[model samples]
Target chain A: MSPQRSEQLLLIPLRLAAMSAAVICFLIVALLVLESLPALNNIGWRLLSDANWRPTPAAADGAFRVTPMVVATLVITAGAVLLAAPLGLASALFCRFYASPSVAVVYRRLVELLAGIPGVIYGFWGLVVLVPLLGAWRPPGASLLAASLVLALMILPTVALISESAMRAVPQRYVRAAAALGLSRWGTIRSVILPSARRGILTAVILATGRAIGETLAVVMVVGNIVRFPSGLMEPVRALTGNIALEMGYASGDHRSALFFSGLVLTGLVMVLVLFANRLGHRGAISDA
Target chain B: MLDRVLTQPRAKCRKVTLPDRLAALLVWTVATLVAGMLLWIVLDLLRHGLPHLSIGFLLDAPRDAGRAGGIAPVLVATAMILIVSLAVAVPLGLATALLLSEYIRRGSRFAGFVRHALEVLAGVPSIVFGLFGNALFVRYFGMGYSVAAGGLTLACMVLPLFVRASEEALRSVPDDFRRAADALGLTRAAAIRSVLLPAALPGILVALVLSTGRALAEAAALLFTSGYVLRVPESLGDSGRTLAVHIYELAMNVPGGESQAYATGVVLLGALLLINLLTALLGRRYGAQVQGVRR
Candidate 1:
């Protein structure tokens, strides 16, 4: 065969393998949607409004209610982001401007290692450590407080890594220019470098938020998995992913379908967050280009 | 010139004094905080788990919470899952990477789509993968909550990471090697196998180790699919509990569970730290080879 023909032939198999990934993703979406539709049809929009979690009797045409879990997901995620964003950004800034190269590399590796530690470990740690610690302060340790702490730790690596990369990508010329214009080093970072990296940092926050929302094992271990509206930080609450994991095995009929519906909602949230992050990444790349 | 003269000396003075001190303080504070958190976590694990550590605990199956139960089964199961998942993921991931880096150009539409899709896949939650595995592997394939199903599901979860890392490693290999191999009348596949694959092995090893560490710690995806059986896996299809899942079950279901859970966690953490250190050492060794080739 000619060289060009051989190259073309090779490309065929490559395309086929790449296409397999797309097909898998499509299958995931389709399965989630199809399984969820039964519950969606039954619950209608009431699923979002009703905080009550009790599934009605089969004769009553009852559907699985998700409002409480949805609220818990949002509340815990927001609480986590609230805690992680500032600390992550601050750590990124410190790494960019403060640490020596050796120290920075060590710190970066630590962050990466922390990031790579599995969610199950985090859940285990939270259950043993954070929950009891919180219980002393409150009633039970397994509450939003414990969940938020674990979530914050879980998402910290995402935020820190992305923000650090963004900070590094900020042109040194901008900092030099600011210094030349009489701005202090910290002032330059605050006014110039951070603003330049804002888009990337925001993208990281979104990605971290998505992670916080979709987390299961860690949250489930610590969050108490109570299906109720969260009244306080110490109150145990159920989240969508946790609910799905906890009950997916025993769920029958509408309950099972409702669990799938929760997955669908979680997927939608993840897709949106990922889309925003992707757009930000592209914009950053284009601007750099 | 006068402005420059006055400003330069004053700026130098200020840098040596207030701003320098403040910057140093700020940096040290942040660094200390991060270090503190890491140390606290490690110390906590050791503190809680050390009391439960015994030869018997490492040898026997778990019993009642207060009684001495060993984590030998959990440790063995975790190892099996890691090996099985790596076996499944490494080849497919490397092949995908080879296709992307060597066989395709950077700006190809197909490459871009695959790259984006992989990112999306990487971002999908573990729970979603668990649901998929429960539906597809455990239920449809009749794996029945065995190590095989969990390992296969985790292979899917880590495949994106491997592909992206391997592609990166391949991309970092110099084009001169390929050109030289081509000049020697080597086939494309031969060049890749002889030159590129060897060059990228360290990076590929790094990716594999990282994925293995992740698989060892995975619990969410294994929750339903692995079925948390407290027994040694006799085969790939046997139900078993990983260290992570075992910890979860013990902590949640058993009384005085925290002690055993902590002990299992310590073992897992120790394994992870060792893997990370080994990966770093391997990366350094292979990194020198790639650097030497470049020079």
Candidate 2:
């Protein structure tokens, strides 16, 4: 073959792979929607509005209510993000402004390592340490609060790293401008630096929220999967993810379909958060330019 | 950094401000907390996990439903799954990345669409992948909960990460290098192979490392598709359990295997830490992506 022909052939495979990359979401969406068809048809909006979860393969009356799971998912996400966002933003500010350059570099690398460590390990640590530690206060220790704390730790690195990057993108001239205006150090950070980096920081929070929503194993390890609407931070709650994971192995019939439906709901919820996050991230970038 | 302080002569003169000191203290405290969290987990893992993690624990198969003996079969299963996933993801990821970065125009609508797709892929949760894997590979394709099914599902999960990071890596290579190659009368294929690939090699390697970390640490996607049978896998079709799956089962299935779960957790943590350290070293050596840790 001619060199050009060989090049064309090489291009074919790469193009195919790229096409695959482009259509992966289509495949996933199709699969989730198709498999979830039965559950969606049967459960309808009850999955959204109902709070009860009963799985009886025999009675065929087992309702896979999604309310508690959805509520728990939101609650866990809120609790974790509530703790993570502020601390993460603060740490980002600290690393960006207060730390010397060498120290900042090391801090960033440590955050990377923290990010690279997987969710299962976080879950494991939560199971062994956090749960028992919380047991002192809450007895079972595997409460919504413990899961929230673990998730807070799990997502802190993401929020901090993204926040740091965003804060770093603030032009030095602005800080200098604030200094010229006789603004104090904290004043400059709060007034000049944060306002400039606001879009990026919000994007980080959105991304971190998505991370918390999608997180499964770590949340499962700590949160007692009791399938009840959480009454308080110390109460046990089952998230949408925990429900799918718990029953996916041996669940059959409508029970199985219900699990898949929960997966669908989760997919929908996470995709929304992700889309919002992407929008904010793009806005942040555009504003930066 | 000091230059900024030095340049601000007025601020530098009265450097001992309360707010500055407070910000310094708070920042240091947060940094220390972050650092301390990492240290405490590892130290606690070592304390609880070391005694049970013997050579027998690694080489021997489980004797009593994971209550006693080693995790050799889990090791084999994890190895098989990782190999299958790596095989599928690495080639597809690099090719797609190359196509996006080199073959496509930078500002084209098609490129934007592809980027959007990869971003969507990244955001899709692993448990959702679990459901999709069960539907596509397990039921529809009739793979029947085999390692093949799990591995393929995981491949789908991490392929976007591979592509996104690798594209960033490829794009980071200066256009001057491609121009240099073009001046030498090389064809597009040859230039990409000889010049582009070399320049992007480190970034590509780093991408591989990140994807590998995701694959190895994954549990949710594998939970349904892989089928948690802690037996040594004989082939790709055999139902197998990874260390993550084993730990999940042992840790959650009540009180019998708690210590063993902790030991396995240590092993899992070690495996992950090793990959992370390798990624750090690669980033340090390659002079790329020290700042770019993808989600």
Candidate 3:
């Protein structure tokens, strides 16, 4: 065959593979929307407002409220981000600046190892250890506090690794210049290096927040999975991901659709967060260049 | 003379004061905290899990929510799924990567869209993928709750990772190799197969190991599509439980299931650590090869 003909033949397979990936994305979004439509039509927008989640009998045109679940999802994710941000940032700083070369390599490997462990393991660990620890100080064994702690652990690697990369990308010249001006090593890191790397760090935190928000197995294992307004860190709460995972199996009529609706909400939240982070990451990259 | 005067005061001030001591303390504290959390997780799993660890527990099947049962079936299932998923993913991923890096030019609109779509795929949560597997594999394909179904679903899950990694590896190959091949009247396909692929193998291997680690840990998607079963899988069509799914089922349903869950967790953790160590060893060997080539 001529070279041109062979090239054309290759394009056929390439096009086919690319098209397949696109179709997969479309199918995923379509299925999520289709499953969610019934609940969307039934509850209308009121699903966002009503706090109660009692599903009346199917014959009674059951009311399936989502307000408490939404609140719970936001609260748990926010709490996790709050817990993770400082520790992750500090670890990132230590890895980038304080650690010697060998220690830094070990630290990076540790983060990678942590990141690879399955979420389910974290959930199992949380159920065994974190829940009981929380229960001793509180009432129910499963609570938002337990969920948040597990989530914080789950997302720590994402936050630390991304932030570390960002911090490392800050120009060495900037730090050196700051120090040459009589600023101490700490001052250079604090006043100069951090400000320069702020965008990257922010992007990392946002991504970690997104991960925490959508986490399923770990939080489900510990968050009590109760659909109610969170009373405190000790009270059981249902997150959007946990709700879908727990109920999608047995749900029928509006209940199944409601679970899909939860998935839809979770996807929307993740898309927004991811897009925001990507934008920030792009700008950080440009600045670094 | 002026530079010396400017530098002398800075040196004198540095000798008298610990300017960055507080910041250093803060950084150390943060590192300690992260290290502490990781240690705690490992310690907690061992502390709770070790009591349940026994020969009988490793060999026998789960009996009840509370007591000792072996996880051999679940271990086998996890291994099968991991191997099956990687088997399906690696080739397809490498092909797509080759297409993107070697065949397509950098600025092609088609290439850009494909890249963006893969990023979107990567960002999509695993639960959504599980739901997709439910609709497509189980419902449409009539696969039911089989290892094949879960494996295929997970293959799609890791496809983007492989493609991205492979593309990156291919991109790192120098243009000189392609030019030299062209000078010898070699076709693009011949050059890519003989030269580019060899050079990119190490990076592609790293990506494969990473994806395999991910596949082994996944549970939520497998929960519905894999359909947890206590018995050993006799065939690809048979339903089986992974260690993660087993942990989830037992922990949620069984009273004092915590101990059993911990024991299973230790097995999973051990698998992950082993994978990491193996990857590190392989990566180091590959690193030396790349350096040798550079020299």
Candidate 4:
């Protein structure tokens, strides 16, 4: 066969394979949307507006309020991001500026290792260890607090890794300029480096947010999985993800469709975050250039 | 470092400010605390789980809803899921990586579209993948809750990660290789096959190892697609349970299942440690090869 022909032949398979990801992504969205349409048509805006969640066989009879779960999901995500952002930034700063090179390398590897540990394991660990610890303070060990704490730990490495890279991407000259101006180490980091890397850091936090929001098993295991508006940190709350995972097996008819609706909401939220993060990341790159 | 160098002459004249010292101390403390927590988790699991984790535990099938037996069936199911996921993901991922790096122009809109799709796919929750798989592979395709369905779900979940890693691997192969191949009048296909792929093999292997670790650890994506059946799966068509799902079930649902759960956790932790070790080894080897090229 001619060389050009062979190359052309290879491209055929390669291009087809390349299309799979896009196709798969489209298919997932399509299926979710299609499956969710029933819930939307039946429940209408009440799905988003109501706070009641009583899944039943009859579509009209069930209250099917996703608001509480969505709120819980956000609450957990917010708490996790709040807890993780500072710690992750601190770890990033330590790795980037404070630690010696060898220490930084090992520290980085360790953090990456943490990241590699599965979400399920984190949840398992939380259920085994953290739940009881929190239960000591509160009546029920499983609460939004436990979920947030485990999720914070689970996502800390992501935030740290991304933030460290963002800081590293700051121009060397910027650091030199800060030094030349007699700015203290902290002053430079706070005033110049942090400001310059703010967009990247925001992107990191946003990505972490997406990860935390999408997280299912970990949140399910740790969060109390009670469907309600949690009044306090110790109160058990069910996240959108927890709602799906815990009930999907038994859920049928309208309940199953409602779960898919929740999935759709969760997917929509995550996609928005992903898009936002990508925008910030790309803008940061362009501005750096 | 530059701060130290620049401030050395005035170090004696100007005292380091309180915030500077405090910030440094804070980061160090946070780093220490984080590391300490990681240590605590490992130690606690080992202490509680190590006693029950034996070859017998690994090889025995569960007798009573996972409270009394070993994870032999779970292990087999895990391996099957891993096999199917890797089988599907590796080739598609590699081809996509090749398409990204070798075939397409760098700034092409289509390439950007593919990458965006991957990024979105990567960010999609594993549970959503479970739903998608349940709907598509299980119900629509009528595979039911089987290992094949679960593995196929995992394949979709891991594809983005594998592609990103492999693309980086392919891109790291020096352009000089292409030039050399061109000088020898090698076809594009031949150059990619014999020159590029070999050079990128180590990185691609590392990617494969990492993806395998991820696939093995996944439970959310598997729960619906791979139904929780404890029996040793006779074929891919049989419903099976994975170690993660087993641990979750034992920890959450089964009464008096804590010991078994701990034991199962130990297996997962052991797998994690092995993966980390493999990654470090391959990384060092890849580093050495890259340095060789640089020199």
Which candidate number has the best TM-score?
4
Q: List residue ranges in candidate 1 displaced over 4 A.
A: A1-12, A49-51, A56-63, A282-289, B1-28, B54-56, B65-67
Error of 2 at B100 (Å): 0.8
* Ranking of candidates on lDDT, top first: 4, 2, 1, 3
Candidate lDDT (C-alpha), each = 0.78, 0.82, 0.78, 0.87
Off by over 4 Å in 4: A48-51, A282-289, B1-14
Fnat values, one per model, are 0.37, 0.67, 0.49, 0.70
Q: What is the lDDT of residue A217 in candidate 1?
A: 88
- TM-scores of the models, in the order given: 0.91, 0.93, 0.92, 0.96
Q: Return the top candidate by lDDT.
A: 4
> In candidate 2 chain A, what residue range of length 10 has the lowest lDDT sum?
A280-289
Compared with the true structure, what per-residue lDDT tens digits does model 3 show for residues B1-295?
A: 1222222324555442365666678778878777877888888888888888888888887776435668888888887877778888887788788888887786799887877677677777788777778767877889888888888888888888778767777876777778888998887777877888888788788778878877888888887677787778888888878888888888887776777888998888888888788778877877787677667
Per-residue error for A231 in candidate 1, Å, reads 2.6
In the range B1-295, model 2's lDDT, one tens digit per residue, is 6324623325653454687668767867988898889888778878889999999999998978899999999999998998898899888888888888888897888778877887788888899998888988899899998999999999999988788778887887777778888999898899988988887888788888888888988998999999898898789989999998898888887468888888998888888888878877887866743334221
How well does model 2 score by local distance difference test?
0.82
> Residue-wise lDDT of candidate 1 within A1-289, one digit each (tens)?
7766776776676667666566667767877787777677777676766547766424135545688888899999999999888778877766666666677788878777777677877887788777888899887889998899899988887888888778767766776676677765566666787899899889888889998998998999999998998899999999999998888767776777777778888888998888888887733332110
Q: DockQ of every model listed?
A: 0.42, 0.58, 0.47, 0.61
